[model samples]
Target chain A: MDWQIIVDSIPALLEGMGLTVQLTLISLVAGFFLAIPLGVMRLSSNVLLSSPVLGYVFFFRGTPLLVQIFLIYYGSGQFRPVLQEWGLWEFFREAYFCALLTLILNTAAYTTEIFRGGIQAVPHGEVEAARACGMSGFTLYRRIILPKALRLALPAYSNEVVFLFQSTSLVSIITLMDLTGVARVIVARTFDVYEIYITAGLMYLVVTYGILWVFRTVEFRLSGHLRDRALDPVEALKLHP
Target chain B: MFDLKGYGWMLWEGLSITIMVGFLSLLLAMAMGLIGAWGKLSRNKAANLTATTYTTVIRGIPELLLLLIIFYGTPTLIQNTAERMGFDIRLDFNPFIAGILTLGFIYGAFATEVFRGAFLAIPKGQGEAAYAMGMSRMLAFRRILLPQMWRFALPGLGNVWMVLIKATALVSVIGLEELMRKSYIAMGAIKLPFTLFFAAAMMYLAITAVSMLGQRYIERWANRGIRRA
Candidate 1:
């Protein structure tokens, strides 16, 4: 309830917000690119192509992200000598790199599934129509299927983005000075845990709402011609009554 | 290249704690979900608004941040309020209790949506038919609505449960000595982070795999007598 404490802490918390936003943006971009091929592999008929992707998705989604973060950050240390020999120790040594790597891998798993769902959801008839027009292989996928799948994937992908943003908070545990980490530090120093946490929570709320707004705008733009202009009276009745 | 000798008991104990917390929180979340769904569906504006706000705020923030707030901030707030009331008392949170409460409350928001959607999927005519048969609202709900809602809610709730199980790991960060904490301890002691955490990950995957089997059974049970697409 102390307004002054929250106000005074804004500058410090905003600094942490920078790192949080950076982590989310970088991982989401990297994960998005990596997930495309993985998603395609996930839908393949060949066991060789599909099973590994399945296992990757299962492992990442099955375990806690915190555990994954710990495994990558600390577990990498156990292989320090091997990592050094391979010249990868330098990348693994920095907490920032470790956090970024974990985020990218984790998000890639979830995004792969989302993309696969979207791809599968592409209409069968439309695909056939494209084939009837003699469109085949890469051109068919590029010109027709991929665009629709991306559109279909937008809502779920946005949810993943929100979840990913919230998850960046976990990097604070690895000693990254993200928003949550800075909040913890401030609370420890000032013993004003509630106020500081509330402030941080509000900052998160603002960011999340902002993300929602962007997704809404994107959905609105992409949904043209697909969305019903008028609500169905029967459906409305069923919902309300 | 590490050994787990003499650490079997510790790991088992941690697994038990993880299951314990997961079970208790699942129960709490189900209870919250029921109440939350009722509130949202009720005719009262206050009830609807309260449910809406609860789901919105909880879903917006990070679960880890919420866990920390509940674990560290609640007791301090309570003690300070008690002092202001001229009562000298100290309050402390049991990490187990705090973990269950926070996780349950957080997941409850998600459960609310699941239950709400499930309830809505049930046709209004079924309840109306019961009422026309001289059945009271409570009886009508019990005999007509609950079973079907369970059927519709099962898959969504199953996904929530899977996430909830993994979320128990967050409680370890609050010092609850769950599976993740045990792995951390073993890793620190043995200097074998790779082995310990890999084992922990395997244990989690094992639990999730078993849960998937259970979910498939429930889904089959729920879908019985219903036509499929």
Candidate 2:
């Protein structure tokens, strides 16, 4: 293993990592906000409200994000005249914006499902108790339902975030010099495919494991009351045995 | 204004390749999953650690990066090792083989967890009952454990299958000429990116829809003996 090549490449890869992290954070933040309402609507009994959200989720989840990026970045060219007329051509013309748009839209769809599951998993008895205590409408959801649902959603949402981070590599295909993109450039230049890729892979592993650690800590903190403090190890062993 | 007439055959061929890769990788992934689950469940510490490391590392990296590493790096590693052994050989790695192996290996980590959870969910008494009936371990596993494990594993496996099929699209990056690649080529040839990609997206959605229906049928068959609310 050539430690020198791997060391020299870190700065370049880190440069790309900046964009990758930015892309992930921006899309996740935007997607989370969009997903809240979409998730709520997804759980609605009204077909008119729910079906559109369902379709949005289905379309995004069904197709690969790469195709979505291509369609937005390249397909938008088909409507250049219309976009130009509406003065939106500038935004669509940039690959960065197109990639970000696709990421936000794609993540929003998946996040909607995650949030909906969390929302649905909230116990009915608790909602009834809140209602019996005069909490209703927005107040009930804001005070009682949202907190519990978000807590339930956190684990799944963390997975979604990690997956989204890995997926940010796809933006490399769209000509953005993200981590994978930069790694590709270095490999092409150095012809040291294995070492370069291994370096990049390790960088990704660090980020992924770091995220896992953070989420685990968050889960431990949030579920403190749910922990059993007095469980006997001998009894646990007997149960398993 | 897209020219499907010119590229319809290419798209069809791409769809076939996509389906082929998906099914082949799914089978390979399940095999690996079974082995992984067994390893994790086994009493040996080494087997347990090996399986744990496999799942952890594979799950941590991007699938795209893994595919690239397998495609570009494996042959070089093999050839260099061969040279060091004083044997001159050149290995021509097939992209199809690379794609299937990489995808299968990546998804296998996920499938391992699914199968492991399913194995754990099965009541211990079922297997013990088989043993008490003078059945061998293999017979007990086949007759009693496998059936119940499938019932528990099917839904999770279904979700994995859905993601696996979509993942086949990623193989196009390695130049497998799958549906996504075909769309890219067609778009370049005809200059109608929207039309070609929209067609590709529809094909993917169609495949997903069909698989979902198939999953429901299998789930129904698996659950036939169980009472549902």
Local accuracy by lDDT, each model: 0.90, 0.89
Best by DockQ: 1
**Where is model 1 more than 4 Å wrong at Cα?**
A229-241
lDDT of 2 at B189: 80
Candidate 2: DockQ? Answer: 0.58
Model 2 stretches astray by more than 4 angstroms: A229-241, B1-5
Clashing pairs in 2: none
Query: For the second chain of model 2, what is the TM-score against the true structure's chain B?
Result: 0.96
Model 1 Cα lDDT, one tens digit per residue, A1-241: 6789889999999999999999999999999999988998899899999999999999999999988999899999989999999999999999999999999999999999999999999999999999999999889888998889988898789889999999999999999999999999999999898999988998999999788778777777667776686334233222220
Candidate 2 lDDT, tens digit per residue, A163-221?
Answer: 99999999888889999999999999987889999888889999987886787677777
Q: What is the DockQ of each candidate?
A: 0.64, 0.58
* Predicted structure with the largest lDDT when compared to the true one: 1
TM-scores of the candidates, chain A only: 0.93, 0.93
